[model samples]
Target: MSHATRTRPARTSASARRTHTELLSVYLNDHLAGATAGTDRARYLARSCRGTDLGPTLEAIAGEIAKDRRSLTDLLRRLHIPARRYKVYAGWTAEKLGRLKANGRLVRRSPLSTVVELEMLRAGVTGKIACWEALRQLAESDERLDPAVLDDLLHRGHRQLHALEELHREQTAVTFHASGPQAPTPASRGTGAR
Candidate 1:
């Protein structure tokens, strides 16, 4: 190999040399132990990285911040990146999280149908209680509704009454494959001569 090819190139201009020296000093200062640069510094680095490849620029700036000590979180914040936790509803099975429509119909599945039914029951019971109190104060009161029947109200709407009256209406989307495993057929006993 030629010695010229092996040797580092000399800076031809004093201005160019100054820039290189400054860049190197920043790198070393940030690289040193216990030297922490703030978000302002990181922003400057990201801004300086424009018009250049992001990977190399980010890497170079990251090197200046800390060779191995800086956290990705710190770096991102320094770049003025906002902290926003995305609400992803993709493929999650959490009940009441989605009300997606599909196949020209809305559908709901039971995770705790009894609990939801009970909540509705509680509301109805509360209303009934209020009415009973009012009626007792007045002259009109029904003796049939024992007012203490809230305990059994949870199971009151357990049956499919009136084709989906939908006491606590909820909905979500789901995808499923129709193809199932093929079943093996039994051998013919007559042909095989039992």
Candidate 2:
């Protein structure tokens, strides 16, 4: 290949770049809103978890999640991606709704509740890893984002996923195996009902 081609950045028309940037900004913001809700979940878990083993760990994870959300907003500012308030509100509302799901019990806490929430947190962390990876790809071409920062965010996402997965396993085992190994029926499973 010619040196010019090898060294030259991939080219797109100005209009195309603008359109792509606009789309990406919206997409990132949507995911940012989701991440915001994930932080809420972490905070809720930290507060609601009464178990001696999971409580402190969940609190620490909640702190980390808050930091991650702050880092994301900072990145958005650096990129000139305007924050959409409505999306943020929507995310918060969704998290609140998630809390109302039935978890085998009517008025009291259920072990299954923790298991389900942990799984949701794990899913969010998975998405966070993807978000960081997407931005890391742009870091190669976009000057506003630091590759090192994205790398750190990705690393933190991995750590969050690891912690969440551990909690998920422990919670599921505790929730379903209270007696012994048994087949989970529809009612016994996470159907959000008794």
Candidate 3:
């Protein structure tokens, strides 16, 4: 048979293609869940920190996160992948549930609460960085992705992590090491004096 007339080597098997599609769907769904949760956390942090030293930074992060979420949606659309709405809903629900967690205080915002939240936000940003890196790796094989955009997102994620870490450090120090009111002595307590 002539070289041009010969049949090309077979591509991936139908079953293998289906498996790949399934795995890709699962991967995208998982990333969407995390992105949704990160969006929730960012908004919460921005609102909760309003009028405080961390407010502006949180607001900026929140805005960036919102944009990132939109970008993820766009990417899914570009790839013709339907997002799992259920997972998105669940992620938002989980974020709401997180807000109800009890701190040591009954009515006041706990310093520890901010500390833990900063850590969680930082971790989420870290995860975002990973997602961007993974997508970047696929850009060579997948024409739907843009490496430049992924690079920009990866840089933003790192910046977000740095800002969160700085805030976390400052808050941790203030919460744990700053001078504070000491407990009343026995004599003072007995006398009913603060």
Candidate 4:
């Protein structure tokens, strides 16, 4: 048979195609879970930091995060991938549990809280950048994936990361370097000469 009549080596069986889709669905669902947690955390941090230097920036980033999550949901729907609700619930629960961390304050927001939360948000944004890039690669072969949309998401993720890093640094300095009360005591720093 001629090259044109060779049937293109069967073009992957339907079962194999289904498996591929299933795996992609699972991967996207995992990211969706992370997105849920990140969105919740961002909103909380924004609210906590309200009236401070980081307030407006954190609030803006939180809104962008919610928008990103929606975009991911839309992509899943377009690809006919059903989101696993349990994973999303787990994400939400995890964010809630994160608040229980001891930050040297029992009744009020610790300075440490802002620093740590910004770091976590930064990490989430980094992951989101990776996710968008991965989907962008798939867009080359999958008509359901949109390269332009993925590119826009990637751009926003980078912007988010930069903003988070700035907030993290500012909060870190305030939390770790102040002298009024939150500063580390000399004994807490150990008696050894330095």
Local accuracy of candidate 3 as per-residue lDDT tens digits, 1-194: 67545433333466677787788788888889988998998898789889999899999999998999898888888778899999999888888898887668778888888898898889888988888898899888999999899899999989999999999999899888847678887877778546
- Model 1's alpha-carbon lDDT is 0.32
Model 1: per-residue Cα lDDT over 1-194, one tens digit each? 58765553553466686775465334333222112222223333345444543325333433433422233233324323332222111112211232232324346433343223323333433333333343233223434233343222212212212112232232111122225775445664346545
Instruction: Order candidates by TM-score, high to low.
Output: 4, 2, 3, 1
* Candidate 2 residue-wise lDDT, 1-194, digit = tens: 79778555554456678898899889888988898899999999889985668998899999999999999899999999998999999999999999999889999988788888999998898988898999999999999999999999999889989988988888777776757567778876786656
After TM-score superposition, the amount by which residue 16's alpha carbon in candidate 4 deviates from its true location, in angstroms, is 3.2
Better by lDDT, candidate 3 or 2: 2
Off by over 4 Å in 4: 1-12, 180-194
Which ranges of candidate 2 are over 4 A from the true structure? Answer: 1-12, 180-194
Candidate topping TM-score: 4
Pairs of residues clashing in candidate 1:
none
TM-score of each: 0.18, 0.85, 0.85, 0.87
Those runs of model 1 whose alpha carbons end farther than 4 Å from true positions after fitting are: 1-108, 140-194
* TM-score between model 1 and native: 0.18
Please report, as a residue range, the 10-residue window in candidate 2 with the lowest summed lDDT: 6-15
